[model samples]
Target: MMVGATIIDIGTRKALEANGASIASGALAQANDASYDIVSDGGGCTDAKFIISGTFTTAPTENTTLAVYAQPLDIDGTNDADAPETTRPTVFVGTVQVNNVTSTQYFELLAENVPWKANYYLHNNGTGQTLSAGWKMDVIPYTSSPSA
Candidate 1:
């Protein structure tokens, strides 16, 4: 059976606010993971889209898609130590490693279902030459689509 094109255009209001940090060389940061928070008036209880863009001093070996997500805990809790929460969510968006490491390159991550959290981390699944520094992320939350 074949279904005709529904001509679907999920018109949802979305907005992205830039709130991130930079990771120093050999410094563990909470922003090095996947997760998002509510940035709209509709509340951060729904899923939203994401578009990650930044500059990297070091380039990843392969194409990596860093998962972006939101958690219910404050993973950035510090115990007088500088090491941030290393155990975060990386299932939403994956960081795609490109070959451009000289200049600022843009990375796009489109998420559907987002939640209200306080931490977003970048998940690293491989142990290659680690990236040195220079990285930032942009988060955009949108209203959910209607269910038919």
Candidate 2:
């Protein structure tokens, strides 16, 4: 679902390229599409944070808000706020807190090579009405090194 999210390295990283062109080349191209390729080290992991910075074809399911959570424990089942650490992973990032405008809403998160879990939930936070339809979270994972 976050396939559309852009990825960046947190520190020292090698130059990235797209196809036969470097990231700069791609950015300079008419299409202007590019990304960085990062490799991880040993047991040590890196941080991959994501921020909501895109658009939705349609409005969200009316009053429905999307919440992203980190669940490193069990891969399945729903999480109750009570024992989130046991059921859910962690609240590395929260929702926009308010309805996202046509502009852009922000949701942040961090990911590591250590099988960190992630999930999104939709709820009607507005009055009692539902949401529109289209909704999506733009994510970007911070990297440590470009080429390991």
Candidate 3:
């Protein structure tokens, strides 16, 4: 299930806070790929934000998109490449617009009622362009917990 909003306008977004939970942040240098990746620990994670930047010598073609996907793994699935997308992965979880060669954009994923153990995937729909992403995953205190 989807959580939060499906809006792309960052104008209405307020500064995000992780509250008291631990956050894992890292640089994502992934290129266009056909496979999904287990980004990191989602043990106590509730949401994830992918801030993408693409710096190029020349401006890239217009309407290019860089996508971020979070696929909920099957309960009985093993952490391996063999777990095909059709079986347990969901594609196109979120995307960023890279209309310019030097583009900066972001996309966020928030879990619904229950937390999901999923892997993150990145892909660029266009070729001949170079892009990189910085990813941050936020852990929210479990709502049902007394301390939350």
TM-score per prediction, in order, is 0.52, 0.33, 0.43
Q: For residues 1-148, what per-residue lDDT tens digits would candidate 1 score against the true structure? A: 1245233233333333344465432333446344344543325445444555555556644554344444444435532212234453433444455553546666666565543454555443341334334456555555533444
Models sorted by lDDT, best on top: 1, 3, 2
Residues forming the 10-long window of minimal summed lDDT in candidate 1: 77-86
Candidates ranked by TM-score = 1, 3, 2
TM-score top scorer: 1
Model 3, 62-137: lDDT tens digits are 6665455454455466543332132243444555555664544344444333225544444555534544333232
Error of 1 at 104 (Å): 1.2
Angstrom error of the Cα, residue 6, model 3: value is 16
Give candidate 2's TM-score: 0.33
> Higher TM-score: candidate 1 or 3?
1
lDDT of 2: 0.34
The Cα RMSD of model 2 versus the native structure comes to 14.8
| lDDT of model 3, residue 148 | 13
Q: Candidate 3 — which residues are off by over 4 angstroms?
A: 1-48, 77-90, 103-115, 132-148
